[model samples]
Target: MEITFKANKNINQEQLLKLYNDVEWYAYTNDMPQLQQALLQSLDVISAWDQEVLVGLIRVVGDGLTIVYVQDILVLNAYQNRGIASQLMEQMMTKYTHVRQKVLLTEEAPDVRHFYEKNDFESCDKGSLVAFAKFG
Candidate 1:
C-alpha cells in the first residue's frame, strides 16, 4: 500500500476515535471531547493516510524549549509492518531532535519496548530517572 503522510491538524474526530478504539485505548475514547481538544492543542501531529483513510498517526506535546512528550502513536491493525509507523517516528524524532528532554510513557510489553528501543528510546528503569504516574 502506498501510504501518504500529513503534517497537519485537520483530522476529523471520528477518525481519531476509531483509531484509538482499534488499539483498545478506551481511556481516550471514554471522553471524546477531551480527546478532540487535546489533539487540537497538541504541539505537533503527524498522520499517515492510505488514500483518504487515516491509517496511522503520532502526536506530541511540548514547550518547544526543553521537553517533549510523545502523546500517541498508532496505526490501523491491518496496516502493521508496512513501515508507516517507522515513518511517523522518523518525522517526530527529526522534528524534536534538538530538544533537551524527550519522553514517552507506555505499557511495558516486550514488543512495545523493542519498538521504542529501535527508535533510540531507553526505558526509564535503565536510565538515571525513574518514571512515575498517578492515574485515576
Candidate 2:
C-alpha cells in the first residue's frame, strides 16, 4: 500500500475511534468526544494514510520547547509490523528535534519496550533516573 504521511491533518471522530479500536485501546474508545478533543488539542500530530484511510497515528502534547510528551502512537492491527509506527516516530523525532525531553508512558510489555528501545529510549528504572505517573 502507498502510504502518505501528513502532519496535523483534519481527523474526524469516526476515523480516530476506529483506529483506536483497531489497536484495542479501550480507554480512549470509551468517550468519543474526549478523544476527539484530545486529538484536536495535541501540540503535534502525525498520521499515516493509505489514501483516505488513516492506518496509523502519533500524538504529542507539550510546549515546543523543554518538554514534549509522546502521548500516543498506534498503527491499525492490519498495518502493524509494516514499519508504519517507525515512520510515525521518525517524523515525530524529526519535528521535535529541538525539544529536550521526549517522553512516553505505555503499558509494560516486552514488545513495547523493544519498540521504544529501537527508537533510542532508555528506561528510567534501568537508567540514572526515576519516573512516576498518576492515573485518574
Clashes of each: 0, 0
Cα lDDT tens digits for candidate 1, 12-112: 88998888999889999999889888888999999999898899999999896799999899998989877788899999989888998999998876479
Every candidate's lDDT = 0.89, 0.90
Candidate 2 lDDT by residue in tens digits, 38-104: 9889998999999999999999999989999999999998998999999899989998899889999
Question: For model 1, what is the C-alpha lDDT against the true structure?
Answer: 0.89
Worst 10 residues of 2 by lDDT: 6-15
Q: Look at candidate 2 and tell me the lDDT of residue 88.
A: 92
Kindly report which residue stretches of model 1 are placed more than 4 angstroms away from their true locations once superposed: none
List the candidates' TM-scores in order.
0.93, 0.95
Off by over 4 Å in 2: none
lDDT at position 27, candidate 2 = 93
